[model samples]
Target: METVRQRQQRRQSDAAAHRQRYTNNPQLHKFTLKFSEDTDVGNYFASHRIDVTNSTICNHCNALKLPTESPGMCCSNGKVVLMEPTIPPLLQHLFTSQDDIAKDFHDKIRFYNSAFTFASVGVRFDRELANAKNGIYTFRVQGSFYHRIGLLLPEAGSNPHYLQMYIYDTQHELHHRTNTIPNSNLNPAIVEDIKAILDEVNPYSINFRYISNFPEEDIKNLSMLIHTNIPGLDQRTHNVPTAPQVAAIWINNNVPPGAIQKRDILLRTRMNQLIHISEFSG
Candidate 1:
């Protein structure tokens, strides 16, 4: 029977411990890779020098550097792969944004070490799905995600950092973002690349983590904003829409003429899938 204060203390202690671990070992946690076809994956990996070999050290070390008829690319290490024409940054930002600025809506997020930004990532094969095809493979990429959290009470102590886990998925969040935005073009090449990646996945699980860094004062202001219900707080009528509703309305109102015409394209694509499934029988 832990009291609320005791629980808070425990959480603080745990957060401190997590931060300490991250400081000692920094890594990447949340990341994505997008490509249209098998060739694209190969090219990206080749360009990045991503090695698939199990040996930690290069066996051929200096042998491959010499000019010879049969020279070997003895680079035993490489970086993670990401296609150039993947989802644009806007959608990525939107996916990772704090939609409501003043809401008391905060989720516990973690960071790796003391880094405030992303860095090099490594991969670890958790388990391979037998269904890998078209350049898509279901495997875990080892990376570190970091967040620096400030205490609700500044006097309470140091802000904690954390390192979190990452799991991969092929559903491709880019499509969802493109669908939601008005007047956005669906590039066939990009779509094909995304589809190719999606086809490669037969995932056992995909974890969605919402993590961010914020200060204590920001938390208080957010709490006040949410508690006050500023979206509905109109000096005259008190009938204003909430923050999210306002955002939706703005998106609709600001849609370009071209976007309106193409708006149904994504919707139709989704509906057709549903219709096909509904018509199917076991």
Candidate 2:
């Protein structure tokens, strides 16, 4: 029995084989002699003495690259969703700011692979959803996520661990700053201060990640609907409203003069280009 993983691997292998076969001979049965390769496009650019800015090595796939064409899309295309977290403005200050105060957090980032990872805790389970007789158990997944200072695990009897700092500060951490960090002079305050910065900028990181992921998913979904048989969502693209449509909702009562000029121009241009073409007689 082929598992889900095995089926996915097999499909991928078949796709690679098919693409290789097409690349070897790109001839079509009755097409207008149009053809294209499936791999290694960089070689063609190199042969033509064209130096492309993007590297031939894909940063995401690492296994495939089409630097001259799609730098990162050669492998995943729209199937894989890559979520890039937007760094909050305040978070970037620690890394780039040259202020004397911010330099403390900046050093820890360079020295240790220090990063912020917050976990949401404590949610009330709805009685209707948690009915054991019907075998349904779920918790409401909603809360305000924030960063903390101490070890990842909550200390015993601590209601909220947001402000609790690890007093021990361990030899590995304490000695790390004292021995190697600049202006240390056996100072232990660096550890606590760094943690403080991470706590304050917690929500910024979450918002950034969600914003980046929110659109990439829908855009990829829109691509799939291009070939769909559905009428309304075809190339009309009603999923995302146009600028004019969005603006019209706000100023429904009083539309400014010349407001529809841009829309009128587009309509006129489309109408002009719709000329009847005579069939070719050979």
Candidate 3:
């Protein structure tokens, strides 16, 4: 009963609505990966170099794939595929500048001082306690005095990724005992607050310590985190991955045991509590 023009207009309106919903709805965006057999999904994504780890295909989209794996056989039947946003430009800039500073100064006193300022703070993963299955880990470090440090788990590619940085404070200190210099301005409250939040998520058990002199082991771990990405490449290198990419690498490399143990404990405790309440109510 509808005219051709009316049908076209209706389709356009439907598409506009779908786009709006996809962009605004977080739940809709969190769906996992899917794929179809009939289509050449790999070829289609070649230009974009889709990160297999992050990409996902919806059930509807997967249904459209043909049985063949050939390039021409795979075709999109107007099915929508959602893609996650790339790393933020600000993070990319920070990494780029940090890499440049490292190359220019190496390990000179001036370079080390500048590196601390640029990274805003120093952080290290306590490998002795990190575990992947339980998803808990400890971290310790020294940095600008009284600076506000924050740990962030920004949503990325259907998975939440974490980052920690110092938001405030910048100062220097000297260690009188060894006549050595250290970043004395680090804050204890920030570390405790981070641990408290981790306690709730139960992702990892975290312990934080502030020291006048950087712990040798902690410094080693922090160095690994900062230089986890490509050695000499800038933000635009073809093979050089993004900040999220490097963060993923760092997490994969360091899995703490204590953190995992705590995560299991928290998860079981919460689950049991919920079950008890449910039974009583019913």
Candidate 4:
């Protein structure tokens, strides 16, 4: 005996109920974090001490002192001086840049905190030097890390880039190679050193093939892959309460039991799981 209008209403109600059921299901919430290009480097440097330099240097005998039997040849002065090695400023800059990216998006991306999963891909370009006939270029790339919950909420600061992340080539390699232009060959030693460092850090994950020569299309494709794979990059349906549900819950808690009391309890419980942000909230 129902009319066409009543049938339509019933169908809509069923669809909404199904959606709610799916949103509340815990099995559907698995996700990972990915970083973006704009994450802050300064904060990362401060936290990880990546920019802190440590090195070993040879001990030498001073002019006024004689050398001991330690290793090097003897000197007139008996006293030998110890020299601590120092990292060049250019190398320090590279570590700082990578750290910045990691810190910037740590909170927004949920999976970043789980273990230490991360991935990196970069590009290498060829350019002609000012005075040389050969090509000189550098390789660089940035990776992102973020969680699924971040997509639905605004970041703590108004900075949109605050939620982004990045890592790039070292300044020393870039500047030195670029200065020599065409004459400079791909320094196998330097390349091996970089590779060793990456392996040592063991960032969540890594992809080294996407060097500076990657085309624009390739860049776009890589970017798409990052977005799809990174956790929390896209907004998804969750157990958040609608405006009416929030109002109903508020009212029920403040007043005596009413017609909406049962629904309010369901909404409040769902919101608790989906919208918890206590860590970042003061």
Candidate 5:
């Protein structure tokens, strides 16, 4: 196992070698060495390269996952319902001053976690495909959401997100993502305050999961905020949702999607059969 100090030294050596390779190539340097922080942060990151504080659940701590072992041994797998609801910080200073810990965090591009990712939208239902059992439709969901984008609001968009900021390309594409979100129906004060807390160019949000059937067209980009309770919010490495609250999001489904407009009698949950209580079912 490599010690942290040894790892740092190796990283520095690797970076030096990389720069040495590009030093003679002026044109390539002009293209790649654009960001002032480029040398500080190289191209790729391994799973181990991620700092201890970044991952909410640890494969080792929670599940005892080993480098040699496969996943799915514990809650760290990220598939099960989160046992603990310790959601991480919404924001961190990417440009840290002269502190070792801060430098260590920022050195690895900590802001990248807060940065947005592309999320494809649009879901179609195809009965023809369903009939053949080849899968109902072509889920050709494209377009990154401007809102604190998907699977994990950090649920994780925007075209390329604010990734171009690192390279300083896509000048025209860089714009306020939340600006496109319709907020006429929401509390402008909350929105404004949250927006103020966020960087206009690179926004970050806590993860969100909800059970509502509200369509994207109906609610628009502000869906995550609506479902989550952002009050003097609980703070942790990863601010997790409260357990009962999260459970309610799914369990209390009075109605299930069956038909276009309740026309499908086969699928609709009748009032009596809506919920099956163990005591009442008997």
Candidate 6:
């Protein structure tokens, strides 16, 4: 296996070679060389890169200090050069910053992760067959999402209970109508299925939160409230619903089509609302 240092050296060499090629033929590889931080450094990165801090989480320690150099390439700030047919001067004159023009073409090129669940949301672009006729260059955008279910499970010592989860695409007026996972905590099959779905959607921003569902009985009760759309559940003696206290979460049940709503559903328990433990009708 190649060591980390060796990998870096190889990458640097490749970048230097790429830069050298661009230098020989500046007109052909102008965009790739445009963002070179220095002529000497190979493999110029064009996107915005975020830095890490000592407080970031790791398996060994949370406070471990990391070196200043980033381990890998950073995310791009949504900028791409239109290398084909080089837009007409009339169109080029309309934009000030190349970045702004990229934005104007695809205003919604972004990704997000919910802070309340292990779901990542992002956009996917395909360049294979974009604007072939017009001599223009572009991409086909597809919505994508990824979720990790294990993170939201209850701790080993906690009382075991049945749970169900679903994902909704607020942007497209679509949802996983069926229960995506049933009796989730007790079964490993649900995790496998969820991974499959993640591969299918392929969302860009995946957000994970320390979230777990209320017991099956609790979710059934909350579903009743949502179904009825009750003005308010009595809470005089009840504690305000907060994180780690939710009953259940479902997205896009009744929202209007093509509407962008908050992606998370946090269900919490309020003491004022009655919770009855019903006997199973086996």
Q: Relative to the unseen true structure, what is the C-alpha lDDT of residue 93 in candidate 6, on a scale of 0 to 100?
A: 35
**Residues 1-282, candidate 1, lDDT per residue (tens digit)?**
999999888977986686476445533222246666555565556454534343343344433333332333453332323344665443344346666421111221111111212122323333322224323454543343322322212122322221211111213333432342234444434434333343344121111122223333564522212234576576565533354322111246777666644221111232222111221121
Misplaced by over 4 Å in model 3 are 1-76, 83-86, 95-97, 100-276, 279-282
lDDT of 3: 0.36
Error at 15, model 2, angstroms: 45
Where in model 5 is the C-alpha error above 4 Å? Answer: 1-59, 63-72, 75-120, 126-184, 200-282
Which runs in model 4 stand beyond 4 Å of their true positions? 1-194, 197-205, 208-213, 221-282
Give me the displacement of residue 220 in model 1, in angstroms.
49
Residue lDDT tens for model 5, 16-76: 6865665555564233224465464545434455344433336444653345445655644
lDDT to native, each model:
0.35, 0.44, 0.36, 0.36, 0.37, 0.36
lDDT string for model 4 (83-166, tens) is: 645654434444455564433333322322221222222222222112132222223222333242222113455221111111
**Which model is ahead, 1 or 4, in terms of lDDT?**
4
Q: Which stretches of candidate 2 lie over 4 Å from their true place?
A: 1-50, 53-75, 104-193, 197-282
- After TM-score superposition, the amount by which residue 69's alpha carbon in candidate 3 deviates from its true location, in angstroms, is 3.6
| C-alpha RMSD by candidate, in order | 25.8, 25.1, 29.0, 27.4, 27.5, 25.5
Question: Model 6, poorest ten-residue lDDT window?
Answer: 108-117
TM-score of every prediction relative to native: 0.15, 0.24, 0.17, 0.14, 0.17, 0.16
Error of 2 at 236 (Å): 75
Please tell me which model should have the higher TM-score, number 3 or number 6. 3
Arranged by TM-score with the best first, the candidates are: 2, 5, 3, 6, 1, 4
lDDT of 6 by residue, 1-282 (tens): 999999888977986685576447745522332334556544444666555554333332222335652332121222323333544443343233455433332332121012112343344454432535433355656444433233233345542212212222222111221223332221223233333444344342122111222234554522222222345855554443443334444465787887864344322235322222423211
Residues 254-280 of candidate 3 have per-residue lDDT tens digits of: 766565332111112322221112211
